[model samples]
Target: MRLCVPRAGDPATATAPVAVEVAAHLLGLVGDPATATVAWDIDWQGPLSVPLTDEHAVQAACGIMHVHGRAAGRPAPLAVDYASTVAGVLAAQGVCAALLARAGGADVTRVRTSVGQAALLALAQYLAAATADGDDPEGCPPSRADAGQELVPAACSFVSADGVCFELEALDAERWLDFWRLLGVDRADTGRGWRSFQQRFATATCALPPVLSATVRRASFTAVRSAADRAGATVLPVRQDPLPPTVTPPWTLTPFPEPGGTTIDRDGTAAAPLEGLRVVESARRVQGPLAGHVLRLLGADVVRIEPPGGDPMRGVPPMAGTTSARFSALNAGKAVTEIDFTTDAGRRAVRDLVSEADVFLHNWAPGKAVRLGLDADDLRAARPGLVYAWASGWGDALGPEPPVGTDYLVQAHSGLAAAVRPADEPPAPSLMTLTDVLGGLVCAQGVLAALLTRLHTGRGARVDSSLFSAAVLVPRGPGRPAATGRPLHTRDGYIALGPRARQRPERLAPALGLAASASADAIASRARTRPTAHWLPRLAAAGVAVTPVCTSLADLARDPRFAPALTVGEYAAPLAPWEFS
Candidate 1:
């Protein structure tokens, strides 16, 4: 692949290639970079510019630091690279899809993605849901008042008596009672439902953690893990290690006669390659939904299959009316249906759906799909040429049969927590769900590749992505130097100064009223002498990449250009990072 490096002095130009590199690595084409090319000179900031006030910048920076609630007072840098990286991956996927389609006899060329677009997609669910104005507001859960309560009660970190921190995730509602029983909690006596259990533990303050920690300390990690497995719960010990990102070729390819279904029609429009493709999604949470969302943006007809009551995420916080802004952001532009897959009729209905689908995607824990008679083999049997995909938290090689794959647990296992930890501080997670977002991107990439291969071989393939692998793919190393340019405090707000400022201190110092010989701390002190408005123009005139940090999605939506990206119907949603031409 030939890289079109942006002109010197533009940091934003470097973002698009991150996705290409990732895709090339996955395709085993990194060694032959000349095979692909990028148009990197695209003006990214023009469509994404938003006004940034110093006060808003500081508040946004603080919002990122306090994402975990537990780290509210801590000084932590936002993982600013995440948005661009994810956008790059999405861009790469689009390119790959277009290339494959062209090779498969479709007329198409030139796929593009931007950091701004990627940032929007990465936070789509949150952004859409938060800005949505619904008539009937969903009631907040009782646990909402508790600062420590996570959305899923069972999927949080717990400390052991020995102070070892681990994560537990019991996603299967049926296994809820069993999990508590294994933890030695008797539901018969306590009469606690899942929500109540989460509420009690989350709000227990000093009471719950100690009891659980003491109890967990009595057993070895292996023993606890084994017990969890027997109870159908996923438990994993948090570790501090580096996990480099890597991708293997597709794992399973089964040849069978084509189902003779109609291929997705392009309608003579080369702009959307995957248009007319029908996707049946039986996935929950961010990973599968995000993947489906990407496919939808590529012009697929995505039909999401939710359980009888609807997706659990529909009830997650920051709701509008009866709708979850998070849910709307992820499921927008797709058809949705409620299905009770546990029933015989539900199974048959899904089987019929699969027969007509080009893709069948899910994130059901291992064995759950099989138990429900909806495993890859079953679905592929229904549609012989179906591109079957599964997203999980861990790869199959992990010792535990099915490890807990929640965002936090995957972050811990994949070494992200260790890598991003500030000196002398415990491991800190990125403010966003990095692994899930990346995993979704990887999953989409794999699915697109599988589709391309199917065009050639006339057969279906199984594509898999896990949070562990996604975590590994993230580039990690020593953080930027403390003295390196960073978000600087202004008398009334904050502004991000790029490292270019540090490299050109002669030009930057005067802009901030600092001497060229000033120390990093001295520069920051000088910056605080003026308000943001006074310095923003000077920094821009000097050709430094600077902006007021966005305090919230709402803040970003206020800008007209950004408003279009975030607004969807009555709700604000993230814009897809890629534009097909």
Candidate 2:
């Protein structure tokens, strides 16, 4: 379902709303009218590309606001006055707060409807505070007044790997209607207030707002389960053990050994633990390339040997000048080279690289490399000490569809879609590349562990990863089979409650007034009954393990704990001036 909100800037100018316009244009591409649902969340910090209208289109949309601070207060004192667009968004927020207070076992009519203009101003003040003193380390967008730039509404169209696309619209201001009124447009052409305008506006933007979807068919889920049953896929379950209350567990963020009493070198280069390591990567897209890239990050001299035309992912979305964002993210910090393995020269070059390399890695089918004469045996023959790693769709080294596998296919074949999608909705594919990223991480771990073994034993070992394996490894619903089981093994399943959910699901269930059968849906439905301010803190303090579902790497880029992954792209110049004295 499409979750969209109207976007407006301080003044609601025609040219300022390009992002929202682009979003609307993309929504126009979905075709059918009856198959979509629009949920609108208005922002109060940017300009708008599309003008607000009073038409029939917007009435059916679910409205929301991009607000800050308590949902109960009138507009708080702020340094600057927000646009009327922001006011409109706050109105929507107030409406929602009223609805939620009623739903969450609170008095309905007596519920304070304090989320009006005054509440919006209060939110603006909190936005200011959050920016100056609050905990938004991830660098969210700035309000127009703070940036000293024209505020325009922005929006984006997101398509999941499984081909489900949706539009998200963000406005810069909540007092949007006031600004429009100040513009003095003719009453002959326009309607009354902002609410009336929005109700009518929905009709013009979309007959039925788009419902973006990324889901798998139940039939596909059943089929894959059947095939896995035949092939013997393993299922691992969740740990239900309770933690001790008195003793605190020690956790370390550092992953490797540090040199004792060693200071930074004059040139600022840290000593490489695996300095002499040389790796040849035949990985193309994110999964395989990410493995090689990780090795490079850890001080291995990795050469990403691509096909004659380079990896196909180079043409994927988010291109920067000459490279795709995906490619840049995966292949950064590694040396890039091309070879046509089908050609004699290309094959010869790879063999030459392999001869000097300590590790040879690729994400290909089981025996295709052997047929192509680049298999482990062939490489081992040329270079005895080379560790070989291969990532596949399935782990057995051979299967019917041993051709190739991507994240989407794995989500379909594995029961992950069954876990993520809503019960009545079709099984939707996940937006995040959990399989690809996890498989890459696993592949790197395998290669490194094998390398350590090689150092001790003087012989190489083969490391393998499967999209199928990665899919099965991530935790799923409580009643489903644990991912650790043998192929086709059935067991009780449970959902992940995040880091804070350490109170044990069984314990938290009673406090939250939920029974064992209370599903994630029930929890989400209840959570929505209160304002974000009230719920987020309460959940955390109560040790309720919850996290946003289906967030992406782009989203994590703003997170402090996980920001390191986003920095991968900044290493384009390996030995740049910043690295030297």
- Maximum-TM-score candidate: 1
Across 89-154, the per-residue lDDT of candidate 1 in tens digits comes to 665676666654454357654555555566566666545543666322211234333435333322
TM-score each candidate: 0.78, 0.45
Q: Report the CA-based lDDT of candidate 1 relative to the real structure.
A: 0.60
Residue ranges of candidate 1 with Cα displaced over 4 Å: 2-17, 27-46, 50-80, 100-106, 134-235, 244-264, 478-486, 502-511, 514-530, 538-545
lDDT of 1 at 515: 69
Give model 1's TM-score versus the native structure.
0.78
Error of 1 at 522 (Å): 4.8
Predicted candidate 2 versus true structure: per-residue lDDT over 1-581, tens digit per residue = 23333334432221212223322332232222311332322232212122122110011000111121011111111111112222222222222222222222333221111112112122211222222222231123342322443222212122334333222111212333222223333332212222222321111111111211111111233432333333333211111211111221110011112111111111212333334467899876556886776566545689888887877766643344466543565576688789988888988899999887878889875667978899876777677766788877666523554423555445545555445332333342333344565566456655655554444445766666666655554434343322210001012111224322433445445435578566655654554455434444555566653432211223322334322212323211111100000
lDDT of each: 0.60, 0.39
Name the runs in model 2 displaced over 4 angstroms. Answer: 1-270, 397-404, 419-429, 475-478, 481-581
Clashes of 1: 12
- RMSD in Å for all candidates: 6.0, 24.1
TM-score attained by model 2: 0.45
